[model samples]
Target chain A: MLDMPFIRIIEGLNHTLENVIAPEVESTLAKGQLFAVVEILKQISGRFDHKHELIVEDIQVSQQMLTTLIETFTAAAIDIPDEFQANTETIDATAMSGEQLRQQRDRLEIIVSAALDLLNSHRAEIVDAQKVEHTVFMQLGKNLFRNMLLVSQHRFDKISQLDKED
Target chain B: MALADNSRLASYLAEKLGGSELSISKEWQNTEGWSMETFSLDVEYTKGGNKIEQAIILRRQPVSGLLEPYDVSIEYRILSALQASKVIVPETFWYEADPAVLERPFYVMEKVPGDVHFVTQNSDPDYRLIADDDERASLAEDFIDNLVHIHQSDWKSLGLDFLGDPGPGKNSALQQIDYWSDVIERAGVRAKPLVTLAVNWLRTNAPETDQVRLVHGDYRTGNFIYQHSHITSILDWEMTHLGDPHEDLVYVLGALWRSPAPTDWVCHLLSEEDFLSKYEQRSGISVDRDKLNYFQLLLDLKAVGIMATAANAFAQNKTEDLKPAAFGSILDLAYAALAQHLNERLSSC
Candidate 1:
């Protein structure tokens, strides 16, 4: 959710190609090709947005984590702040737009993170602190696994064009 | 600004070498390095009525990328200090801080001749990075030896105190945590819950380092160069600093650099047990499993910082290079890896 938007990324690519790369290119054919690619990207920019379902799914996962956190706090007799509960209640995936859902998810993430910090600070006072911590870690692991499935394998070797001889 | 200007570079070299006529015969920027802008310059010049040819390397700071706010002079000084030591490094020539010259701070050094293996080179069925057994053994020996030498180096005698020692006890661990944590914050990324959890865990459980030595901030397989069966030089000292020697050991054992299943070799040269045994035997420092586990988590945290930094650079339109963009795109993968590691460690606890 913290990643740059697809439209902004496209804009960046076009800007780099036109401003940074085009003037340095010596061959007319290659320069034209670069511009063509820029044009193509511009044409496709309006049609792309981050997948809505992914953001919704991420929000759902975060809500599940907050629920578990609240349950743990209650079981331990630890006080849960009103703001934490308020943010958790605001996460209605059906009502929010994609960007709104993303922002809401990000807000919940910060609150949950603050809760974990508070939990660690007073770990001695809370019974079964380590067990609750384990549950949070497992939830995080599940979220990570879901996100990772969408990422394609990286070809870092091609990034630098080191394999090709000039 | 242009990445490199051959004519301007040749003129600068001519004045430095006391040569009247000098020219850059060939020059190529090495894009392989993600941090510094490295250019290999083939120079031909006349000095004292004699014609001389030299292969030189120029490392310039990028506008922005991974490990931002760079100062190439630190790396230059490190290489210069190691010239008389047992560590084999490229000989430093000169460092130029005047941005008018190359549009950025850069330094010149001797171009050490050898082939630097990239991870892509390991395409065999078993994913062996070094296909030749004898060659792998020889390179492995040099790799361990160079690391041991680096850790055993006398920083005070070498006048490398400019790198700043972290003093004694747990300062080394605390200093690194502060360093990477600051990097992530500066990148302007929302702190992920996993990163926050890891940072808290690291701060609470930092190990003590009794003896501090010069740690090669990046000691790994691809960072070294080899010719035939000998490792000619250790490259990429950008991250060099004074810290725990175990930091380097953990980096060498990072899963990202190791060969995949079937081969399962650390750095594609030796088994994990073999690497540890050799390092222990040579360095006379027993490996601490507890500290190693601590550093493994720290390493993952460091990766997240780096990836976030790269992504931030691109998001801000600070650099024209797409490589940083590509690196930033993989931030999720980094987070996932760190999250998975945190789960395993917490589960064991």
Candidate 2:
């Protein structure tokens, strides 16, 4: 078991761009939009009350952004492993064609974007805390925190090995 | 003082203790490494079965060093002078500049204990969390206030005027920029494009120089030690030199110190604006925003160049710590930031 103390969040925002009625086709261009979204989240909000909200929002939005990014990445015609999916054997035996993969990537991009907007809407209501579902932020922050821990641990392992060897 | 095993230092200290029979106890010191490497030392001397215990630091020069090499006498003299000028510092105990004693110049000073925040872009959860917003703001304000006091300090009669004369050229800021740029160019392989661009921009837009002030070369969050909500000591001063009055300000507001943002004040508890205001009120010298921006960019450049130089040395196997491959990654990450900062500054200019 481990404990890493978190710092105070100074500025937090729920910056969202809604394009549900008008979808973005160029997922490659959408990647740039995701970067802006991350930048906006990087702002540190108040440390005492809304910080937990921001932390949770950061994780959900980050994951949602990554999901969109991966879709666009694959839409640009990337070969991905079936293991990335749940129950890979259960998926259709019909191998996805290049065009089909691109479409899947594009459509999945919309789903991810929706997920991000969902988080944004949840965050938007925070000016008045009574409006937001109490359990929502906690659930999202917890999930995102878990994923971040995994990624950080992976990088740290590589760093330790490199440090020891060099 | 606690000794890192395999250090041939204890016997060396005992043999040099003159006629007094000596017993040594050691403790760890986690601070400055410029003038002298410090370690806590407790010595007991017995003459005719009567013993007296004394506590001090074992200060020695590093054989293969990282920072600029300094003369031992300068530190001894400066601190001795500051003690008289009302600057809080450890009382100097002993100084041995002869290499024959410890194979390097060394000195011992009084040891003070306190909590240190180096701000590694990481958090420490142990201390009571500042559960309130207003308290964090107050802490940030105090930290900046200290810097104001430091800048407002009188070194006129302090005898610290003996350190270094301002280099050639009446404009100290340009002179400093030229000097650091030259150092960067000579210290690396191919010039880093971003740093090179920043250097050129600084040369083009020189800030009007002010009266020379004592610049603590490495004044950042990590340098100060604190205890019970009070700053105990400002640790590193090896890079202390006479130069631009804005040098210290830029360092405090530099990208490294602004790791999280200029807002998340560490060690001290105030926003960047709060700190600057405190400085203005105390020192009566309005901090020029233009010069501050230029110097802030310079600070980012200087930091990257210094880090690059270290990584390069480690890569070439010229340094003791052999982790260049790992440390190089840090330089690479910072390089992007340096590039962005350079572009932003240039475009603004």
Candidate 3:
């Protein structure tokens, strides 16, 4: 957190981000955040078409371990748990000044734009490959994101009501 | 070759200019990807009583990267070789394979202009939309036509065979699998479940490709340049090797393509019929659904391996490295969903 360049991948972390985004460009950035969250689950459910089409061999291992090294894997964390510790500290969660936030968002925009380019290309690739129903999966991703926004809005709205009472 | 005020790199570029009075301007870390730092430099000088201004790209390998050797010399060789063969690539100016000057091998290349991204952040309509269906059909044909030119090109003839990694006994896929599996295994606790399953699948049902073809390992969107609906150049040949052409094909048109209309594939620009028709005409090969489907899975496997490896490096703290990190880490997640989809489609087998 102390580092000047410790940027988080706010979005564009996976193809799911691409799917969640493609149709909703006209939507508010607030809604974009919701779709971003739901995309994680949808991506989990998607698989590679040719799962076992390559081969790996190593004499040192003596056996085809066919396993991902545990140390390198990161478990997905999505519950938005009541409290959870970050691997590294998030010292300043407080909002930044408008200019600072815009700069951050501007950098993020570039990263996100690259992702959209990739997604557009990927959309073509999937369609060409005939991996899935084009509209079904991609639109499913978009619709799922829309629902995600609805759910997130509900949660925030309840919080707002409680705040008014306080 | 040298960026503004970075004395370390300035000295190195000075060596490449062959004693020319090299002054550097506009040097800044690209801060782009998670694999390597890309620096842009403006080299100004007089070559023959005429002033010359050249914009170049310098990629310095970080402490750790997803690709090995990270040799700019190799890239220079590969690009130069491809240029000779009618493939579009950034022109290589100078390369230093030696690790002395910059404490790492680095290369400088002339920067090619034009937008490489097909989609803008604004979701600017795909450039393919510039043409009507018939014209779009031709563009799609031109796209695959380039690919056929690539696969049919003689690797030995082009001098790129030596630029890649090959195993002692096994073919390219096995070598790649072995390499990536090792990466995953070395990742130890960080290995995702999907990768393990994908590896097993890759091991059991390998594609039966015998003849070797040059594979532009990451031949997909975000790796090519286009101008006015023309495919300008193919970029990011970092994972080049000898493998099955289907590997490149499936990768080029993998799940990367999604459509507003379910049937309108071809990355939402060209239709599948149009793209494949062009490929068949250019490549002179017939496709079998089963085999094609298998290669589709291989594309995902390769992509996921890359992401997993990148995430591992980032975890290890090579932050300056630019490439996708945790890029498709959810690929573990995607593979699971896509597996069920693939299995259903392959049920006849």
Candidate 4:
């Protein structure tokens, strides 16, 4: 991962902020913010080594959730689309970049949304459709929370309201 | 600086004001807001053989913004209408639709004197909105009173119907759902299953409006200006439109606007009970808890829409400003809040 060009780009940003941009900014407030940017760049560089591992783990979780959801719907005799069933089969997470893994997750999410919609369309008539829908909704909710936690693992708390010190 | 040429703006304003001479000095530029670039300037001009000076601001729509390819003229008309009403807003002066002047559409208005407090005083030493506890309580009272005034005013009387009335029934909720859904689609971000589910839930549970009033879409803390312990003017009407009043109330009460303290103060000004009771008493409208909760969820979805738009703009390289990109950084927090709200709604279901 160190050989990745993005890491070098992050390094260059850090160098420029520390050496060039921070010095040119006149306001004390602006300079402090510029240095903050430098710090963020350093943080990004620190994550490069484990970036793939994190993305793979997230993709694995998403796939596992979708696979379970499909089996649950099938057991309930709820008809899901053939394409939706096929997409959740597997993904080459190890070979994929973070962006690609995110795309895969998004694809699974869309499938889950379609399945939920299908379950809901007949919720009034189908005897146990409500139960099936609840189960799918709960699983999707947990998946979203876990995925968000992965995405924001390194982000800072939002800065205190404008001009107030943290 | 977003303002390309200082002299061009000066010349344009001089002609507009019918002044013999005019000079514009840049006083300050606010980098906090994402949609509009706020530039404060001291304008000195000679008009009718009298020299006059005043502080004003230029809110210009940048190419890369939270809500882009939008008409600044809509905001101009809303403010113009509200100026005659009870809502405390900046005195709008002019609206420039041509992009040639400042490279984008911009408007000029009087710069009300004040600062915004984002953090609670106890948490942040620099919190300067109000020092005394009494003044703080008064400001909260006035804040609710101002909101009541806004809610009570007749939008039709103010000639703000050009904002397109969403009509009666559940039309208001449906219209907003359609609008923000379009924004999310245009934003073209990765599929957000939670947002999609939330939108579905909102559609399924769309509430009927008792009355349609002018709804300030972004009526939260960090959007208003405070001076001497009183709110001088409510700023950021860019998202203002005709909708259900509950929309505004829900936005004001959202988690994003509150202090981290244990108090249930809305915007760190008034307690929840006090805010609602005062609003009900002053506005003569009963508070609807179910509708408030519904809109709270929708507002969170709207926030996700905003972040998606910002992320889209950042991805498209429309602007290199870090602010829009920074908005994307908070998706996790927004998602967590949405999930909590979703769980609550599911339990009721």
The candidate that wins on TM-score is 1
- Which portions of model 4 miss their true places by more than 4 Å? A1-50, A64-79, A95-100, A128-130, A141-143, A147-166, B120-129
- Over B1-349, each residue of candidate 3 has an lDDT whose tens digit, in order, gives 2333366666667667654566776665544333455677777755556667778887666556565435556656777888777666788777766666666667777767655433211123443423456544544555676778788888888887795536333355676677666755554321332343345445545656656777787765456666656667777767777777777776656654434344445554566666777777778866556666766666655554555556555555444322434342333443444454445443433
lDDT of residue A155 for candidate 3: 26
Tens-place lDDT digits, model 4, residues B1-349: 4366767778988887688578985566775666787888888999888998988888877777577656788888888889998888999999998888878888889989988755433444344334578878877877887888888989998998998999999999999988888887787642455666677778778999968888988886677888877888988888888889999888878765565456646787777788888888899988899999998888877777787677666566566555666676556666677777876776677
The DockQ scores of all candidates, in the order shown, are 0.63, 0.01, 0.03, 0.28
Question: Which has the higher TM-score value, candidate number 2 or candidate number 3?
Answer: 3
* Model 1 residue A166 CA deviation in Å: 11
The clash count of every prediction, one per candidate, is 0, 20, 51, 1
- The C-alpha stretches of model 3 lying farther than 4 A from their native spots are A1-166, B1-11, B28-36, B66-69, B98-100, B118-141, B163-172, B189-194, B320-331, B345-348
Worst 10 residues of 3 chain A by lDDT: A53-62
* Model 1 vs truth, CA RMSD: 2.1
Of 3 and 4, which scores higher on lDDT? 4
Docking class of 2: incorrect
> Which rank order by TM-score, best down to worst?
1, 4, 3, 2
Better candidate by DockQ, 1 or 4: 1
Model 2, span A20-120: residue lDDT tens: 21133358667667656645555433222322333333334433444443344354444433433321112131364333433343343334333333333
CA-lDDT, candidates in order? 0.83, 0.51, 0.51, 0.72
Tens-digit lDDT string for candidate 1 (B121-208): 3445566778789999999999999999999888889988899889999899999999999998888653567887888778877899
